[model samples]
Target: MPAVCAVLAGAAACSGVPAGFERPEQPVPTPEGYVDASDPQPISEIAWRYGPAPWRTDAMGDPRIEAEMAGIPYAIEFYGCDQGQGCTDLRFVTRADLRDSDDPDKPASRQARVWQANRWNLERRFGKVSAGEEPGELILEMNATLAGGVTRQNLDAWFDWWRVALTEFQDFTAR
Candidate 1:
């Protein structure tokens, strides 16, 4: 019994790092030429608090547009926005399209605005989801044109169509 008890005590002591015997903390990554003690918790907090919600344009754009906000792409409201006028206004349009930047006068600025506006459209779509519903999964099937030369009239027409088509998705909640 004494021998068994001694072995058990030895095993227990070595089973894991005992009290206060911790390894020195490792340093976090820092930018080149940066040298200052910093806390990462605030950075993470800022991300979850200030960053765009996962259902934002980039996230929703992933995997497909149809089934916007839960499997649907909101491309239904982008009819007639062709290459000439630029597909900047449409979120479902690929990043490559925006990178073309033909309108050199304000290319970067225009692309940023285009991305932001498309995000708003995505937000509107995601907002329509019901309680405990996916935010980007509904696929919308429509014969629409994304060609450039989209005038205000064309934009308005599509808006009206989508307002009706997406009426059911209005006021959706994030699951």
Candidate 2:
């Protein structure tokens, strides 16, 4: 009985630190609020939070929401989605189509568009600016990771940041 008790105590102590390393703390999942983000219903609520947004399909047929931010039309897309497990990330993207002259004869220079994107990227931290595949198209994107889930307040704050960033970008472009 003494030998068995001694072995159990030794095992318990060894479990605390294995191979001279402390057990890493596990990450606590962010609490879910009114909606269970894991399900797709929260997506409609998300769209509702930002005004009237219509559901659309992306090129690949994945669900996309058309919403306007800072008076600019943008698409909200989901990534890392599993039919059984649900989506883990959400992205908001907009394409600013530019034309140098009112006349279709001339198009905006790629260099100018790239330069603008580079400037936006250098100046901003919330959203990323990039030159799109098409000429004279500038892309702005913001992404949110929902790996563990998020609180309603935090999610609202995230939307707030997106709006602020979009407004700032619009102002920047106007200049």
Candidate 3:
């Protein structure tokens, strides 16, 4: 009986599982045209960097930026205290007639796919993202607290990053 017990222990040790083996890595879908926000440009210097083609203030007087890929539009609207108070939040939004499908499940399923894909990419850069839907739009939004008091310099940097990140996200959704 002692020998039998010893054999069982040996067999257990010999099993294929490693002592610290974790689950296999699952494949994740990466958004096409996704840009890493490794090097961010300060907002104040944006005019000198990009030549000011698609960036402008919207009708509401908030800063608005646009990005397009495959003829699809993606926009970022910045909101915060007036003047150089700095932006506290930004919304990345896209609109599609997902509800046009006769089958109700189709829109919901598509929304879920977009949400999942964008969520994965956004989380990598900005940590947690709040995702949801409006009447005719899908939105992924993030809020941030500036390390220092809201200043024009910080706002510029934040906007610059948002433009690049939102453009990348828009490209991903276009695919």
Which candidate's lDDT is highest? 2
Q: Rate the local accuracy (lDDT) of all candidates.
A: 0.33, 0.71, 0.47
Name the lDDT value of residue 96 in candidate 3.
43
- Ordering by TM-score: 2, 3, 1
- The sequence of per-residue lDDT tens digits that candidate 2 reaches over residues 24-87 is 3543354646333345556656667777677756666556778875567777787766542456
Instruction: Give lDDT: candidate 3, residue 56.
Output: 65
Off by over 4 Å in 3: 1-111, 114-123, 127-131, 134-137, 146-148
Clashes of each: 41, 0, 2
Give candidate 3's root-mean-square deviation (CA, Å).
Answer: 14.4
Model 2 alpha-carbon drift over 4 Å, by segment: 1-37, 56-61, 83-85, 101-105
The regions of model 1 sitting more than 4 angstroms off are 1-137, 141-143, 169-175
Backbone clashes in candidate 3 total 2
lDDT of 3 by residue, 26-114 (tens): 32222343221211123323423433326566776666656443344655555653542334345545444333234554444545656
- Best prediction by TM-score: 2
